[model samples]
Target: MKRLLQVLVIIFPLAVICQPNTEVYLFDLNTTGNQINITNGKNISNNEGYDNQPSFQYENTILFASTRNGQTDVVSYATNNGSKKWLTDTKQGSEYSPTSIPTTKDFSAIRLDTTGLQHLYRYRSGKSKVLLKDLKVGYHVWNSRNMLVSFVLGEPHNLIVSDLKSNLNIQVDTTIGRSLHNIPNTNLVSYIKKNKNEWEIRSLNTRSLETKKIANTVPNIEDMCWLADGSILMGKGKALYHFNPKKDTEWKIIKLFDKENFDNITRITVNKQNNKLVLVAEPETTLKPKLENIRWIAGNWKGEAFGGITEENWSEPSGGSMMATFKLIVDGKVNFYEIETISEVNNSLLLRLKHFNNELKGWETKDETVDFPLIKITKNKAIFEGMTFESIDKNNMIVYVAINQKNGATAIVPFSYTKK
Candidate 1:
C-alpha cells in the first residue's frame, strides 16, 4: 500500500542559535560594547567602489549586490577566501535585494531583482530565471520549508505566496503602504508604515491578509530584516535593534555602533550558517571615487599573514598583524626593508602600523610598471618610501607601505599578490 501525502504542522517559535564562528560585520565604523564590527566593507572589484549589501560569514564567503562591474548584479565569493564572482548578468540595469540561505556551501545564495521593470529574476544554481514576472514584487522571503513573495500593482502594493512544490501563486496583501517580512513560523507578515514622522511595525495574517500593528519608533528606519527565531532585527541610522512581538517592547540593542567614524547601515542580513549577522556599511552615502594606481618598486620579496582572521567573509578580527620583506634592486643598486602592520581587531578594513624607512625611498606600480620614486642606499641602513599601484580601470589606485617598524611585536605580512 502506498502512503498518502500528509500536511505538516507549521512550527512556531523557531529557535535559532549562533553558529560556532558567529561574527558581526558592519562598515568602517567604530563599534563599542556589544557592537558588531564592519570590517571588510569595500568592493573587491575596485579600490574606491561601493561595498553595498554585505551578506556572508566570517570565513570570507559573502553574498551582496554590487554595481562595481558596470552592472547591478549579485556577487559571491568562490571560497571562504577568494575573489567576487558575479551571479546575475544583466547589462541594462543593476540588481538588488540579495540574501543568502544559511548553509555550509560557499557560494549558495538566493537573490532577487527587477531590473527590466517587467520581471523579477531569481539568481540561483549559477543562473537567473524569471521566478515571478508580470507583477509588482515589493518584498520576498525564502526558507527551507516555504517561500513568501510580495508584489505591488497599480497603486497599492500587494503580498503573494507560492509553494515550491506546486509553483502556484496567491495574493496575501492588497494594502497601499511599505515594507514587509515573514515572521519565522507564524503565518503572518510584518510591515512598517510611516506614521507621522515615525515608522510603525505591524503584522498581517497570511491566511486572511488582516493587518495588525506591532511597534512604532523613530523615522530612522532604513533596512529591516528578521531572524529565523521570530525576533525582528532592523537598523535605524548606524545602530541595530531587536524587537520582541509578544512582550510588546524592544529587546536588547545588539550592536550599537559609533556614527561618526563609520558609514550608514544600509542593509542587514541574517547568515544562518553560524547564526551570524552581517551588516552592510558605507560612508552614509558616497559616490564611487576615482582610485589611483597602487605602485611598488619591482623586487623580489616574501611575507606571511595571520590573525584577525575570519572564516566566512572575514570577521571577529582581533589580530591582523603582518610582516613583509621588501627587497629591491634598482639601477645596479640593491635595497632591502620590512613592513609590519596590525589590523583593527574585529575589523578587517583598518590595518594600523608604523613606518621605518631604509635605503629605498619608495616604489610605485602603474600601467604594469613598478616606479621607485624615493630610495637612498647607505652603507649599513636604507631609506625607502615605496608605493604599489593596482590599476582598477582607467582610474583608481591602492597605496600600501613596503617597510615598517622592526622587532616591535609584529609578523610577516602575506599580501595576496593578485597578479593582473
Candidate 2:
C-alpha cells in the first residue's frame, strides 16, 4: 500500500509587508529622434535599506528618504561631491517624500509617526512645522511658492490642492497614484489617475484646478518625470521609458539600463538643466529561486540521528517559501523541536531554523535565528553555506549538517531519512 500525496497550505506575506529594498541610480541623459542615450551610470544610494523617492533639489543635489539609520529619514546627497547628510532626524517617526520647495531654502517631507499619525511637515533652519493637520500626505508637488498639490492617504488615496498660507485642503480627484510633478515653465502639474485597473497620466491646471489626460500608462505606477522638451519619462519594472505626446504614439524603452541587470526601476527625476537623470531602482534580480528540483524533500520522513528518533515534516513549496518542522524523540518522549523555513531573500534562497524544547519554548532568542545561505544547487542535491542535502532516491535522503564538537573537533553529522 502506498500513501497519497498531501496538499499543504501556508500563508503568504502581505503586499504591504514584503516590499523590495530599493536603491537609487544616476545617469547622464541625451536624446535624439526616438531614442535616448544613458551614459556614466552610477549607483547613488548603495545601502541595503529603502533608499527611494529621489527628487532633484538642485543641479548637484538630490533628496530622498532612507532607512540606513533604522528608521526612515530624509537624506540629502550631493551628486558631484558624493557628500551625504540627514535632512530630517526626528526620533519619533519616519519621514518620506523629501522635496525642496521652490524659491525657498526650506524643504518638505511627510512625517509618519509611530502612533499612526501621518502629516506633511515643513523643515527649515533645524526646525519642523506641521503643514497639514487633518490629512495624511503621502506625496506632494509644489505648484507655486504658496500652493502645492498632494496625494493624501485615504480609502483609495485622493488628490488635493493645499494652500500653504491658508491651510485650505481641497480634494481634486480620487484613486490617484503618486507621480506628482510640476510641468516645466507652466502652471500645470502632472499626476496619475487610476481609472479602474488602468492608469492615465493627466495634467492639472494649478490655478483653475482642472485636469486633462496626457498619457495612459500601464497598471500600478507611481514614478514619472517631465523632460525639458515636453517628453515624459516613466519607470516600469527594470526598464525606463519616454513618451512624447506630440510626436510619439507610445512609450519606448530609453535603453538607459539593461533590463536583465536591474529590478523595480521607478521614481525618476531630472535636473533643472535637463542633463542629469536620476532614478530609484533595486538591483540584480532575474527571478526568484525555483523549488521544483527540491520537491523530493517535500514530505514526512523518519530517521535515527543524534541518538534519538527524528521525525521531519516538510510542506510543499509555494509563494516563494516552504516550511518544515522537526522533532527529536528519545525513548518515545519528545526531547526537542525545531522550526525551519525556506524562503527567497535578496534574489537568493535561504534556509532558517530555530530550536525549541519539548515544552515548545524557543531556544533561540526572539531577535536571532540560524541562517543557511544557498551556495549551490544541482539536480537533487543542494549545498548551503555550510550544509548540504543529497538525495539517493525519492524515499531516501541525507543532510550533512556542519557542526563542531566540544572537543574542538569539526565533523559533519549525516542525518539519513526515509519517507514514512
Candidate 3:
C-alpha cells in the first residue's frame, strides 16, 4: 500500500473536523554553483489553525488552503506587499490544493463537501462550477489549458488524467503519493510510485500515456518541487535537501534550519522564477503536552525573592497532578505562603496557585486562584502563559512570574533556587 493511502484510511473519517495545526513558511532561495542559500524566511500563514498545500499562482502571488470562519477556504497571498485576499468563502464545505488553471485567470481546487462528496471545481469571478464530477480528486496539477493530472481517492488511490474537452478521465497508475507536478521544460507530469522497499519518482507523458522512472525519492519523503534548473528540492526534519538527476547520485544537504521553528516539513513549492520557496510545517513546540516532559521539576528548592528568603517543595507527578508549596520569610519571620498545583486538564497542563497570609488567612476568595495555561514544554523547561519554570540542573532551578505591583505596573520577577 502507498504511504498516502495509509494516511487517507486513518484521516478520511474525520477529515473535515480534525485538521492539524500547521503553518506555511516562505523563503528566498538562491543557488550559486551547488551552494543553495535560503534567507529572509517569513511565516505567510500566521493564523492559528490549519494552513497548508501552497502553490504559486504567479511570480508574486501564492494560493493555499487556510482555515477561517469555521471552514477551510482558498487564500491568495501576495509575496511582494505581504497582502492577502480570500478567494473562496463557501458554507457548504472546505477547499484544498488551490492552483491556477493554465492560461486563465480562474483557479481549480478540490472541495470536500459536508455531505461527504468530494470533486474538482473551477472558480471564476467568485463563482464555482464543477469541472470533474463523480471523481474523488485529492491533489492535481495542470498539464495544459484543458488537461490535468490528479490523485484520485479509492481503495488504492490512483493517478488520473482528465481531459476536459473530451469529457474523458484516464487512470494512469495506482498507489501513488500526493505530490504531483509538471516536469520543468518538458511535456510530462511527475508522480510518485511507492514500491515495497523504495519509492521512485516517475514521469508520465500525458499525450502518449508512456511512463518512465526519473529517480528514487529522498528516503521516505514524497513532497518535492522542481526548480528552473531541473533540480529537485525536498525537506526532512529541519533540513532542506537538493537533488539533480543529471549529475547527482544522491540527495545532498543544501540548507539546514536547526535554530528556526520549522519542523515536520511537507508540501513544498517554488515560483516560476524559482527564487521563492514555500513550505508547510508544524512549529517546534507543537508537541502534545505531557507530565513526563517536565518531570524534572519535582524537587526541594531554596532561593530568594521579594527581598526575602524563599523555599519551594514540589512533589512528583501522581494522580495526573503535581503539588507544591512555597514560603517567603523576611526579617526571620514568615511573610506569606502559596499553594500551587500542576494538573492535567483536557490533555494539557494547567498551573493554579493561591495566596495566604502568615496566620493562614486566605488572601483571595476560596474559589479564586491565579491560573496559567500551558504554552509549551521542552526538555528542561515548562513554559506557561505568564509563568515559566526552568531547571538549571538536578539541584538548581529558576522560576519567573509576572507580578502586578501596587503602582498599576507589571514586572517579571525571577527566583533562583538551590536544592537543600
Judged by TM-score, which candidate is best?
Answer: 3
- Evaluated against the true structure, the overall lDDT of model 2 is 0.77
Q: Write the per-residue lDDT of candidate 1 for residues 204-302, one digit (tens) a residue.
A: 665455777777643447466666555566764344666666674543344434323233455566544324455655433222211111112122322
Clashes of each: 65, 0, 0
Q: Write the per-residue lDDT of candidate 2 for residues 1-420, one digit (tens) a residue.
A: 011111100111101124478888888877655446778888878888678888888888999888855678888889888899887778877788899988998999887665455678999987999988888677899888789899877778799998878878788999998889988778899999988868899999866889998888845676788888888888764446668888888665444243223555778899988878888877663322557667777999899987899998999989888899999999889999999988877877899999999999999999789999986555556667656666778899877676765866444566789998
Better candidate number, 2 or 3, judged by TM-score: 3
Query: What is candidate 3's CA lDDT for residue 165?
Result: 96
Q: Looking at candidate 2, what is the lDDT of residue 265? A: 78
Clashes of 1: 65
Ranking by TM-score: 3, 2, 1
Q: Which stretches of candidate 1 lie over 4 Å from their true place?
A: 1-51, 54-61, 100-116, 143-146, 151-154, 163-170, 174-179, 185-188, 194-198, 204-211, 217-222, 248-254, 273-275, 284-420
lDDT of 1 at 294: 12
lDDT of 3 by residue, 249-322 (tens): 97755555544576668889999887898999987664468877788888889999888999999999999999
Give the better candidate number (1 or 2) by lDDT.
2
lDDT of 1 at 42: 33
* TM-scores for every predicted model: 0.48, 0.64, 0.67
Best by lDDT: 3
Ranking by lDDT: 3, 2, 1
